[model samples]
Target: MALSLLTPNSLTKIPLTKLRFVPSLSPPPPPPPRAASVSFRRLSIMSSSNGIKVGAAQMTSTNDLDANFNTCSRLVQEAAAEGVKLLCFPETFSFVGMKAGESLQIAEPLDGPTMRRYCSLARDSNIWLSLGGFQEKGPDDAHLYNTHVLVDNYGNIKNIYRKIHLFDVDVPGNMTYKESDFTTAGTDIVAEDSPIGRLGLTVCYDLRFPELYQQLRFQHNAQILLVPSAFTKVTGEAHWEILLRARAIETQCYVIAAAQAGKHNEKRESYGDSLIIDPWGKILARLPDRLSTGIAIADIDLSIVDAVRTRMPISEHKRLESCQKISSLSSL
Candidate 1:
């Protein structure tokens, strides 16, 4: 079970000069470079009762920050043209440093230049963005936080979630990645309201834990779950779609997954199959090519979420059973 070698594919780069971004209205001045508290900013267009269009982007990111930004900018324009209100990006969207200590060397705070450009892009495009798995500078110099940022259409920082489940696996003769070596685990579970619905934020490794998804649905009342990942080819082929569909069915929530695809570097490659699954475990959208750089477009309807939950009514049943078990234990 040796690690398989992947040949890097040449992706067509869309020049920023050719693309156009038309804001719906005048965008406000850029906010100060500081991390804003967790809050939701609703846009007038997002408040409509109809279903909202969203996009999940898949791309191969490298150590070059400028190139990655260009790729993302192009996707934003394409999504906006298709009337997408929200677009989600994959983990490590900015830079994927293959070497040790490289990410820490370039890690920036929330208010850093890297984030400023993304904020400006969102404002100019007038589209909400979910930037998952940014290497954020931590409290100390030795470590960094794998941060996920949600920005509003107006370029406001809505909320941020650091990845709590650090990937520390050592499969003999296969893949061995120790994410905890350089990254610090996040302490909080973050959820926020958006144009689509109540969004539950979780990064790559968080997908393996069902309890996290259950907490998001039962406790946080999250209607949509976002899983941004860079899954290895082996594991992704085995469980990616199955786990995503299972989470959607059990939670009765929409699941949108943005993924990193193709060979990023000689030593690293990702299994890319970006998907958007509905509450009923149906795949609404997915990229035709598993290893291409593009977005999966879909419409998120809250009405469908309600319809599925109403028919199944699993949440209520689970609560009732828990209460009964507690009452029985007390009597004993």
Candidate 2:
């Protein structure tokens, strides 16, 4: 007997299980160069708290932490001014170094000045923040983790998801990065509560794994997914948009991806095109390519999640669990 896997319409990219994770590099979060890298509503197309208004920020984070904070401070103010309840930032939002190993020196503990600043922003603005990826000082003396954090509107932390999947790849002549060299991998999955809905936090490379998303959306009941990334130019152009839209469509949840754009350092260039996608797979708001520092805002409606899932019942029809087992089902 043989087992067969079923996939949705052809619009979906590679068969569900066949997709591979392609890794990329990120710039430091504090200053320009490369550092780092939401949804809703039927609210007025631009700004409001009438519904869930979210912001996606695209930045070129550099080696300087102070400079990067200035950029983030400005964007956070802009988002708050618009009455955005939640803002999603790209990975490495706090610090990226001139080179790879430099992150070791800059990595900070959760209570460090970098995180304190983020908490202050959320508290002052009364907004939730998906403070994507940061260089965290690991338990050991020599390593760091690509950590993702969720801060509530009142400036309290609700979740911390270290990147479970690290970006370690070789794009041959275009680029080759081994994130493991500078950062460690996270071991658990986080689907936590937020003002809008249950939020699932993931980083750049994690986008390629549909299984992880399945667990987030179905098992954990996450209604919105946040991917803060600093995807490299080569892969971002080829796979970023499609991957994001597909994830939204599959999970029937709002997908917010804030990305790193432009050249970050002499060694790296990020693909910018940060986006806010709806549950039905529409691109709601997106930052233009190559923008140095910009915020793309949009409305997010949770009702749409129910509507999409009810209309197309994909989760109910799936035959395989997140990790497929060859012998889970015997011959019919």
Top candidate, metric lDDT = 1
Candidate 2: Cα lDDT at 218: 84
Model 1 poorest 10 in a row by lDDT: 38-47
For residues 242-300, could you state the per-residue lDDT of candidate 2 as single tens digits?
Answer: 89989998898899999887777888888877788878776667643345577777777
Clash number for candidate 2? 29
Clashes of each: 0, 29
The sequence of per-residue lDDT tens digits that candidate 1 reaches over residues 65-88 is: 998999899889988988999999
In model 1, where do residues sit more than 4 Å from their true spots? 1-49, 319-332
lDDT of 2 at 277: 80
Question: What is residue 308's positional error in candidate 1, in angstroms?
Answer: 0.4
Cα shift from native, residue 317, model 2 (Å): 1.6
